[model samples]
Target: MEIVFTVLILLLAVAASGVAARLAPFKLPLPLFQIGLGAVLALPLFGLRISFDPELFLLLFIPPLLFSDGWRIPKREFFRLSKPILALALGLVLFTVVGVGYFIHWMIPVISLPAAFALAAVLSPTDAVAVSSIVGKGRLPTTLQHVLEGEALMNDASGLVAFKFAIGAVLSGTFSLMDASLSFVLIAIGGIVVGLAVAWSFGLVRRKIIEWAGDEPGVQVVLLLLIPFAAYIFAEHFGLSGILSAVAAGMLMPYVETAGAESAATRMQGRSILMMLEFVFNGMSFLLLGLQLPGIVGLAHIDAQMAGNVPVWHLFAYIAAITAALIAMRFFWVWFNLRLKSFSSALRGRRSKQRALDVRLISITSLSGVRGAITLAAVMSIPLAMPNGSAFPARDLLIFLATGVILCSLLSGSFFLPWLLKGLQLDGEHQRQRAEEMRARARVSEAAVRGIENAHDKLSTQLDEADQALLTEVSGSLLATYRMRMDAESDSEETHRVANRFKQFERELRLEALRAERQELHRLRAQQEINDETFMSLINQIDMAETWLLGSLSSSN
Candidate 1:
């Protein structure tokens, strides 16, 4: 208990550094850096170690991360990519177990294939938290991002389901086709039913509590925090998937409805509550990734040494092979499913751009298979001894391999992803430029609306009262949109539509003026008319305006 609390303190320090760095110029990837930091602390001299109980993690950490991710994912996008997400989450996991398990068992005659299946099951889930939290800042296609998000969400439940069956097989020293299939079906159905029931129950309780508290912010936030865990415990107590129950409750939790006409203050308050929860969980997860190193070494050293010359080098190699199969299998499945989506979209003339976009995105997601706390937890929860007083084979090897995969993936994905962003011509500079252009064009709309208002005001004596009221509402909304544009704050979906209409017209009018200003500035620079700083600053102004204009036009719909 002392050690757990101490390790948490260190994790807090690491998270603080990460959160601070996010606001600083010294940008670094979260997974690679934090995990590396923890690994550095794991050396003999540092003597930092952490012991995580399986149920403790499931109870404490899983709820917020699952809820936050589920809540933030745009509902429209989640639904749109549901097909591919479901495939990766469910179909791909089963495929991996069958494929990877068969190969591992065949390669090592002594080990039962069901044992290999257990290894396979552990590696089947993708850690979107690691991947997204690390490098999600980079330029990527929306279609690809949503797909990756969806895959991570559903894959947890699928992998956990398979894991249970494998564990059951090991316990009984027998595997049953009918029972495994039925168990999975029951887990899924039972989880969803339990999750919804709990969501409703907790929501009712929260509503009553809020009325009692009379809108106390602290009470509201506390109630929100309790719902995910409440829902999870309710499901798992009934023998359903606790993780899925968390995800389901989160998905059902108030997004827009709870914050009707969501005020900025209220949204920020809610987001901060979630962000804090995510921060603590994420920090602990990365630390857990590294802290298990010594325990794993102790766990696997004997088996690894004995199996070094064998077809498998121990449990590590077993897990390594399964991880490879799980990752490799994704490429084929993603490409195949995407092509099918493409064909349907092509028939309707709707799918071409996004299909091309997703190809590159899936490649990135393939590298983002960084096993984090969930995978570590699953492996850690592997039964310590079999029913007949025999130890589980390769338990140590499983931990070692899981750690290796996590490291290699964190490094490779974080470094290579930025390069992919460049190759794909998706970068922050483009996003910033585009944002500026949209705001510039929005300014033009505001100017036009102002002119209309002035004319209407001057002619008010000639107009009807209803006409004046309609004009006043429309004009005020337009001006409100303009104000938001100036600050680069997000506007309502309706304001976005109006802003987009004026973009092209503004571009045509201002393009020439901007060009002429550039020519004069160039001439001045050519004649040593301005210093490099001033000339560049002047040039940047025009470029920023143009980008905002273009972005405003494209994103309007």
Candidate 2:
């Protein structure tokens, strides 16, 4: 019953979040709003107490999210930006663990060094889910978005590995720089090796399944869903990074090949499922974080009696200091990288304009380091007691401080991002992309017309007069429509206006045609001439046609 209730609450939160994002008068990032709603619902009078075992949450939520992200991320872009991504994901993460770790220890004398390092590791990785929600589509430069997302994907593994080592240090009451450094390299490399091996095997099986069940989209989506969990479990079983395993599995899948060949229904259904998964996982994670606030605050004071001479406000002050240090270090690192980028680009004889763009992107990337679910999960997973049974040093305070950083990062990132975007005027880049798209579509249409002409010639001898007339009319209409879109750029203003008028007339005709086709499908189903599955398939094609026509009309304007 508790499980059911928890699920119900999460579903409700997800629904509310969707509705709010669509209906709200003012712009509020969905994650931030969900967090606020959850915080409000956590009031004592609301009687909505929520608790999550950090380990369970981490295992359940992180895998699919990471896998989905990896699957969708463009492989070309990811590789091209690999250098900057490594800088942020691995280099910056390690730097933060040391820089912020020492800062936290300085601020809170009671917190041991290992514990401080643990906190730093927990807070180092930025949550891509949170960042994505905060920066919706078309808000950031594409390059910047890709870099941030790439950073988000890789940093989780690095941060968590550092976290494990820090925890090991705390539990064993010893630390060796040489051993830790060697161990870090081994674990990082080993995890990647395990991830790649497991994911490659899974991909082979998945490809076979896709071949066998190619027509069954529902079955295919279910199989795809399982890959992430399977990859995570296998990697973790081998004492490797489950997060990297899931990411690797997603990346290895036949993203490019299958995408072109999949049926429209399959593609749409798969996308819908992944989108819903993201919405639920991200929304619930933030909501749960908000609900945990009161409990977390209470836990922060759990050792109040033992915490002599330390006040709650003082702890908050320490949290503030640590959060500042984290943000400050990111700025410094980003600035340093930008300088290096500028120097390298100069040596290569790149333009000053490119250097300026780099500065803008790195600035946004630096600000986008908002720690989220993974951080919260890692901190909350800290053991309540050491091996000797003494209370884990400053566990509660660490949670509190981590929460402080999460809030600060989210608020600051979401608030200023839009303003920064406005200043950059990145819409020209979007326009350039649209223009390129038009060129590509025109080329495709030209090839399609050539194919039509060939088919007409080949079929003329086989078809009767009526069939020939139908083919001529249909193919002529297609050729005309494509030619108009193809000429949209080079045409004069008056010519474009005439073309748009034709486009509008064509749109109405196409929509009417689609309506007739749908009615025919429904009629066929009702008459028992076609099964429900066949009717649905026909209707889906019609729906897609209608959608494309409508979308094309909108894009033209």
Candidate 3:
């Protein structure tokens, strides 16, 4: 019962935090609001405390979020930016682990090199979710945003794998560079393979089931929700990277959707469910970090004692040093990587127009490397005792430092990112994307118009004169709509504006009619003029129509 209450409270807190974020006077990130609420909940007055279980937390929250990111990320952009993403995710993670590991060891001699490496490894993975929350969607330049998203997706696995190796080294008193490298390759590849296989198998099964039992949205949604968890578990069972498996499953999901095997209802419902889950889970993750902060802080004295009876402020200084070191390392790497890319391009006789180095972009990238829940989870998972039963060295101090770093990073990003991003121009990228979109929309509308005309011509011969007239009229209406869309995508700004205005008027009129229809249905139900089932069916039809109207309106704008 207590456990149940705790879960309920956390869910309520997640909900409240979201509302609070929106209602706050100043515009702050949602994660910051959630973390603040969580911290308040941990106060002595509330007496709310939950034990942090790293394994369970990862299993419960990480997979679906990663999967959703993988599923929705712009695949074209991800592939195009793959070089930079790999450099940051794979190369930077290794660099951070080594660089920060030695820095941590040198700064604080109490923490063993292996344990310090473990800390740095966990810190290497940046939380793109946190970054996204800090900077709203579509605010960052599209290319940079895609690179960051891709980096976040891949680095979670790489960072955690490194952390695993470090922890093993600490426990077993053994280190093997050659074996670990081979294992890393195998683990990463194996996870990707397992994810692809699982996703493909699931897609096949889903198709067969739909054929057998028909497309039921409820059942389809439930099955969709299971894929990430299944991928993670299956990969882990084979000693692979579950994080990558989940991401792989997500990335494969879009292809499954492209099959167009399910009804529109299934797609809509699945999207809604996934969106809600992402919000709630993401909020809970930051909230959990906040809740743990007080308890972690309470142990500062003990950590101070463990660090040779040093003052607690020294721990904070260590955190500041580590955080600064990370940002510096990221800035240096981004600068060097860009410079190297430019040099390679020059050697290859490619004249890139963009500057070789953009300081603003580099600063944004550096600050965007904010750590969040994953670091907390990974550091907390450090084993309490070694194989010989001795306590893990500086365990409390390690957790303290990790928790501090997470807070510091989040704060730093919140404070400085907006300032760095101000007046930054990515107008060229935006204009290119807008032009490409207009072309694509125009092409699609043309195809739709053609399809409708072909269908009408084929059916006209089978119909009598009156029926043929009816078919022609219906087809003409759809063709007009498609033609209007094409007109809206015209190169002429004036022509596009006229078409868009007509679309807006049409949408508004349709929505008004839908609302009236809904009201009539409700009136009939209240007066007992219609049966409940009939009223419900009619209302659902009206609601779906309204939903489509509003969705189209928003998309068009």
Candidate 4:
């Protein structure tokens, strides 16, 4: 009952955080509000405390969120920006592990090199979701945002893998560069292979199920939700990188969905359900962070007093130093990559401009490396005892430092990112994307119009006169709608306006019809004219129609 109540309270807090963030007069980040709510719940008055389990948290929360990001990220842009993203995700993670590892060790001699490396490794994975929350949609350049998303996806695996090795070294008191390198390769490749295989197998099974049982949205959505967890577990069972597996599964999901066997209801409901899960899970992550902060700090203070009478302020200083080191290392790396790209372009006789913009972007990227729940989970997983049956060196201080860094990074990102991005003109990329979408829409509409005409002509030849007339009328209506949408994409202002008006009027009428249908269904149910199941089925159809209608209206506008 206590455990159940805690979960219910956390869910409520998650819901309340969303509303509070919206209702707040100031534009504070949603994560801040959630963390604040969590802290309030943890206060002495409320005394809400739940035991933190790193492994459980990672298993429960990380996979789906990462999978969703992989499924939703723009594949084209991700591939285009793959070079920079790999540089940041792979190269920079290792770089930070070494650079920041040594820095932490030097700054605090109490922490062994392996322990310091563990801390730095965990810190290497930035929370792009938190970054997105800090800077609202479309605020950053599209390319930059894509790079960040891609980096976040890949680095979570890389960083955690490094953390694993670091922890192993700490426990075993031995490190081998060659062995670790080979293991990393095998782990990464195996995880990727496992993920792809799992997703593909699941896709095949789902297709068979649909063929056998028909397309039920509820079943399909539940199956969709299981992909990441299955992949993660399967990969981990083989001693591979579960994080990578989750990401790989998510990336493969787009291709799985390309079969076009799913109904409109499945797609709509799946999207809604996935979005709700992302929100709740993300909120829960930050709330957990806030919930752990007070206990971590209090315990650290007690440990500090017992260990060496180290000041609490020294821990804060260490966090600040480590945070600065991370940002500095990241900035330098991004600058070097940008310079290398520029040099390559120059060699190809394509001299670059916008050097100043590159600097600003580098700064933005550095500050955007805000740590979140992953770091907390990783650091908290540090074992209490070593092989010698002694307490792990500076374990409490490590957690304290990690928690402090998470807060610092969040604060810096929240404060600095907006200022750095001020007046940055990314309109060129936005306009290019808009133009490409318009072209695609126009081409697809044209193809659809042609298909409808072909079907009508074939049917007309086979039908009697009255039936042929009905077919012609139905086909003409579809063709007219397609033509209007194509016209809305035209260069001419008058044609676009007229076509948009037609679309708007059509959408309004359809929406009104859907509302009437909904009301009639409710009336039928209230009067017991229809059974509950029948009413629900009919109501769902109406809701799906309205959802599609409104979605199209919003997209068209």
lDDT of 2 at 475: 79
**Candidate that scores best on lDDT:** 3
Candidate 1 global TM-score? 0.72
For TM-score, candidate 1 versus 4, the one ahead is 4
Candidate 1, superposed: residue stretches over 4 Å from native? 1-8, 16-28, 255-267, 298-300, 306-323, 339-362, 425-557
Q: What do the candidate models score in CA lDDT, each in turn?
A: 0.71, 0.79, 0.91, 0.89
User: Residue 50 error for model 2, in Å?
Assistant: 3.5
lDDT of 3: 0.91
List pairs with backbone clashes in candidate 2.
Answer: none
Candidate 2 on 412-475: residue-level lDDT in tens?
A: 7788766666767563556766877767877887888788789888988899999999988987
Query: lDDT score, residue 503, model 1?
Result: 48
Error of 1 at 507 (Å): 23
TM-score of every candidate relative to the true structure: 0.72, 0.88, 0.97, 0.95
Rank the models by lDDT, top first: 3, 4, 2, 1
Residue lDDT tens for model 3, 1-557: 99999889989999998889888899788888988889999999998989889999999999999999999898988998899999999999999999999999998998889999999999999999899888887778888888999999999999999999999999988999999999999999999999999898889889998999999999889999999999999999999999999999999988875289899889989999999999899989989989998998999999999888999998899899999999999999999988887888889999866675778899999999999878888998999998889999999999999989998998899999988888888746777887887799899999999899899989998999999999989998999999999999997899899999989999989999988888888899999999999997888778888998988777666
Q: On residues 403-507, what C-alpha lDDT tens digit does candidate 4 reach at each position? A: 889889998899999888889877477788889989999999999999998888888889999998899889988999999999989999999999989888999
Candidate 4 deviant stretches above 4 angstroms: 303-308, 347-350, 353-357, 516-531
Per-residue accuracy of model 1 over 1-557 as CA lDDT, tens digit each: 88777856676667765875577575556755566666667778777766668778778888778877777776776897787778878888888778877876786555577877887787777877677766665456556677778888888888888987898888897888897788888888888777777777766765666566555556567777887888788888889887888887777776423534333345456778898878778776777666666556565656556455443344655655555665677667777777887788889977466526456667776776666677777877888888888987766655566566666566667666666666675535456556776677667757876786787687676779998788778777776655555433346777555544554455667877888988999999999969999999889777767666665555653
User: Compared to the true structure, candidate 4 yields what TM-score?
Assistant: 0.95
